[model samples]
Target chain A: GQQVMQIPQYQHVQEGEDFTTYCNSSTTLSNIQWYKQRPGGHPVFLIQLVKSGEVKKQKRLTFQFGEAKKNSSLHITATQTTDVGTYFCAISFGNEKLTFGTGTRLTIIP
Target chain B: DAGITQSPRHKVTETGTPVTLRCHQTENHRYMYWYRQDPGHGLRLIHYSYGVKDTDKGEVSDGYSVSRSKTEDFLLTLESATSSQTSVYFCAIRVTGTETQYFGPGTRLLVL
Candidate 1:
């Protein structure tokens, strides 16, 4: 069985501050996907990383995958109120299903 | 928005009762999945179906079962509900072997 673990179970940051979350897996993954879920909302697909040591950006959010394909990170610059949510990392290992990490819950102060 | 819809937005059932949650999709996607989200446990997959009548268990499939008799519908069943099963459930669909998955609004279930 594959297991994905995420660091910083909870984080609180002031508005305009930066934040980052890390994810590590027990096994190599073919691809990794990131998701965001607002409080009391369903998980929404954010982005996916496939290549080793790949980096992608979405506006103020930057995502990076480790060279071994077993770790990933999501960093947000100048966080806003809208950025308050739980971020999850899901890994796929040549299967139809995905194993999701515990997730990092972020809160932005006013 | 991938035309994914889940029925019974909220449900409250007593323990030992049988409950079935329905997931309907208009996108005609071949891959459908059921996941449960709790406070500490982010989102854990219960089961997934790749095609009609073809299904596989996920990490947390002990107390749950799934059926996919048609391409548009996937059903998750709890034979005898327990208090531990209280959580928010999500239904997601995607193109076969694709990374993009569209999730439903989600169903909150409480078992007493």
Candidate 2:
């Protein structure tokens, strides 16, 4: 069995502040994917990191994978009003299914 | 965006009732999954089907059943629904073996 957890279950920040959420897994993963879910929307795939110590950026959002492939992080710089949503990190170990973390709910203050 | 849709976007039923949720996908992917989302639990996989008539259980499969007789359709059934079964359910299709999944709009069920 595999387990994944995310830190800071809920976070509220000003529009211009920065935000970061950490994800840790009980077992090593073959790859990790990040998803975003708006208030009333479904989860949407954002990015994926397969290699250890890998980092990728999408505009203001940055994703990183640990060297052990058991942890990852997502950082958003200068959050905007539209950034209010829940971010989840999902991990998989060479399986067709993915184990999703508890998720971090972010609220952007306007 | 992947042409995935869930029937009865919102549903409300009483205890001891039978309910079914349908997931339709136009992607024609070989893999389809059903997951439940609650306040603290992110997304727990209930079941998944790799192909027509091929299915497997997941971490939280109890009290839930799934059927995939066709590649484009997957159905989740609850024989005897309870309040605990009230949660938002999502159906996803695997885009690749790498585990990239695209989710449907979601179905919110309320059991009273």
DockQ of the two-chain complex in candidate 2: 0.96
lDDT per residue, candidate 1, B1-112, as tens digits?
A: 6888898999999999999999999978999999999988888899999899999998899999999999999999999999999999999997655867889999999999
lDDT per residue (tens digit) for residues A24-104 in model 1:
987788989999999888889999999999999999999999999989999999999999999999887776777888999
List ranges where model 1 is wrong by over 4 Å: none
> DockQ: which candidate is best?
2
* C-alpha lDDT of all candidate models, in order: 0.92, 0.94
Task: Tell me, by lDDT, which candidate is best.
Answer: 2
- Candidate 1 local lDDT, residue A14: 94
The DockQ for candidate 1, computed on C-alphas, is: 0.83
Candidate 1, after superposition: displacement of residue B6 in Å?
Answer: 0.4
Q: What's model 1's overall lDDT?
A: 0.92
- Please write out the lDDT profile of model 2 over residues A23-109, one tens digit for every residue: 998778888999999999999999999999999999999999999999999999999988899999998878788999989999988
Candidate 2 positional error at B69, Å: 0.8
For model 2, residues B1-112, the per-residue Cα lDDT tens digits are 6789999899999999999999999978999999999999999999999999999999999999999999999999999999999999999999954579999999999999
Return the TM-score for candidate 1, rounded to 2 decimals. 0.96
